[model samples]
Target: MLYLKSIGTPLVLVMALFALGGCEQAEKSAQQMLNQAAESAKQAIDKTNEAAQQALSEATGSEKTDKEDSKDADGQKI
Candidate 1:
């Protein structure tokens, strides 16, 4: 009985240490995944904004030309 008690404490402590180490590694992995997802979302948003701006510029440019073409040389409407 004395031999069993002496070995049991060390065994339990070693098991606890391993469990804590695994938990720490899991936390780090989760954090890394979250950071990657956030970066990807930010990049997607940036690309969407850029495309929207380009489309808006093109639309406005065509409208300006149409307005100019409808005017006479004296700046009066045709």
Candidate 2:
């Protein structure tokens, strides 16, 4: 009984420290994962917007006019 009593206090302290450390590490890892997912989603949205704009300009025949306006007959800016 005496030996058990002497060992119990240190055992409990060690277990509590492990629990707290594990919780802190898990939270940091989860936050990093969330940040990466948000960045990927933002990139996807930008690409989708660019594709939609290109499609619209092509459909309306504005793509050719845009090319023409970029230069004069001598291949210089107008």
Candidate 3:
């Protein structure tokens, strides 16, 4: 009985420390995953914004050039 009592307390303490360390590692991993997801989302938004701006410019540029080419009888562009 004396030998069991002497060993049991230290064994329980070691197991408790191991469990706490595992929990800490899991928390760190979860945080890293969240950070990566946020970065990907930001990149996606930037790409979408660039595409929308390019489409808008392409749609509007031709009409502007045509208007500039057409001149009035007074030799001035209307």
Count of steric clashes across candidates, in order = 0, 0, 0
Q: In candidate 1, which residue ranges exceed 4 Å CA deviation?
A: 1-22
Tell me the TM-score of each prediction against the true structure.
0.69, 0.49, 0.56
For candidate 2, give the lDDT of residue 26: 58
For model 3, how does the per-residue alpha-carbon lDDT over 1-78 read when each residue is reduced to its tens digit?
Answer: 334234354445445555677677656665565566567668889999999999999889977878767977686977
Model 1, position 39: C-alpha lDDT score: 78
Worst-scoring 10-residue span by lDDT in model 1: 1-10
Worst 10-residue lDDT window for candidate 3 reads: 1-10
| Index of the highest-TM-score prediction | 1
Candidates 1 and 3 compared by lDDT, better number: 1
Candidate with more favorable, higher TM-score: 2 or 3: 3
Error of 2 at 66 (Å): 15
How well does candidate 3 match the true structure in TM-score terms? 0.56
lDDT of 1 by residue, 16-64 (tens): 5556776776566655655665676688899999999999999999999
Instruction: State the local distance difference test value for candidate 2.
Output: 0.67
